[model samples]
Target: MTHNPSPRSRFGIRFSILARRWRRALDAHLAAAGLTDATWVPLVHLRESGHAITQKELALLVGVDGSSLVRVLDILSRQGLIERRPDASDGRARLIHLTELGEQRVTEILKALREGEERLLVDLADSDIATMLECFDKIEERLAPATDSKDTSR
Candidate 1:
């Protein structure tokens, strides 16, 4: 016999669809700068952080595997958007930092991204947007425990 999925599962699917759609919208906005979603995300994280960030920390922030992150970093470095340097605290570890060009690009890209998000949320009331963000934060927190458990198991 086939088992039926619960309402929560259906809601999860809808959430995923919405996320993909929004990501596509944001990607389109970043494309004008010759950047993809993958490239822009890590750069933005590093720029905002305003200091040398470890590669492992960047990978975790971007939610990408080490190999994938290495490729992404390679491309960004080739583009002169970022640089990698030996970590002061760890001889074997490398730290990533946004270059001058990267910081400039990030500033421009962040402006576009903010505009895109604002346009996307234009139809929603301010209170509704606030509530939506709070809900998203709650969902992230709820999933964190499961994610930590899985990591520990691995």
Candidate 2:
């Protein structure tokens, strides 16, 4: 068998390919719940928090720009899945929460995600799964400090 040393060295390229595949798989799972992978974190946060969270906070948590988050919130609201209201303490800011429909849908999305993940990782042993998650966590921990330092210098 021909060895693929190129891929072995290009970790970023391999990670990108895997990320795309993971996103595609997640999108397919989400379709059944009438949601998309983009909405997953936002909805889960709202449901789990059980209280309205600031739009800015949500944007940061989801790693999206405020304007883009505004658009997504608009669409979700129009779909009757979420609602936004003025923050009581901060009039200039808005708070976001999942509607009852949103709660139901988010629940379904979680279920779909669990099933999707199970199937996706069916070939890997439990130990492999743990190692994979740990590796990603370590990568993020090491890179985040470098990223933060660079941002501060600029």
Candidate 3:
């Protein structure tokens, strides 16, 4: 007898592979500019946040632990990409701010990402993309509870 995976398992495998491939593609495209997913992702998030944010909040946004984010922030600081200042209400809490250079880098990163997306999506129809987005939204909704549970456990 031959073994076969369930639809959920098949979908999971495909999704994971696609995610990894997408990351690798982005990594390759940004390599010349010396921006990896680790460095650029947080910058983009900070730019979009539109306000001062704490280290803990940034770590959550970036999907990394607070300790790990420290190293990344250190690099960004040394490169003049970001600044950390004490929060007004809470002296112990430091708020993360993107420097002028960091904002410029985020713009470049977004442009590169848009170009990459255009190339990848060129063959797909708009309706197909819309349908895919709908399906993804449903999947995300289903996963939200599980995600929340895991976060609470941590």
**Please, what is the whole-model Cα lDDT of each candidate in the order they appear?**
0.86, 0.82, 0.88
Ranking according to lDDT, highest score first: 3, 1, 2
Show the colliding residue pairs in model 3: none
lDDT score for residue 73 of model 3: 94
- Of 1 and 2, the candidate ahead on TM-score is 1
Off by over 4 Å in 1: 1-9, 48-51, 149-154
Among all candidates shown, the one with the greatest lDDT? 3
Model 2 has an lDDT value of 0.82
Q: What tens digits encode model 1's per-residue C-alpha lDDT throughout 17-125?
A: 9989998999997797677888899998897677888887787778899789999999999999999999887898889989999999899889989988998988899
Q: Any runs in candidate 3 off by more than 4 Å, and if so which?
A: 1-9, 152-154
lDDT of 3 at 96: 97
Best by TM-score: 3
Instruction: Pull out the clashing pairs in model 2.
Output: none
- TM-score preference between candidates 1 and 3, better one: 3
User: Mind giving the per-residue lDDT tens digits that candidate 2 earns over 10-70?
Assistant: 8998898989899798888777767676677688877777789888667766778889988
Model 3 poorest 10 in a row by lDDT = 145-154
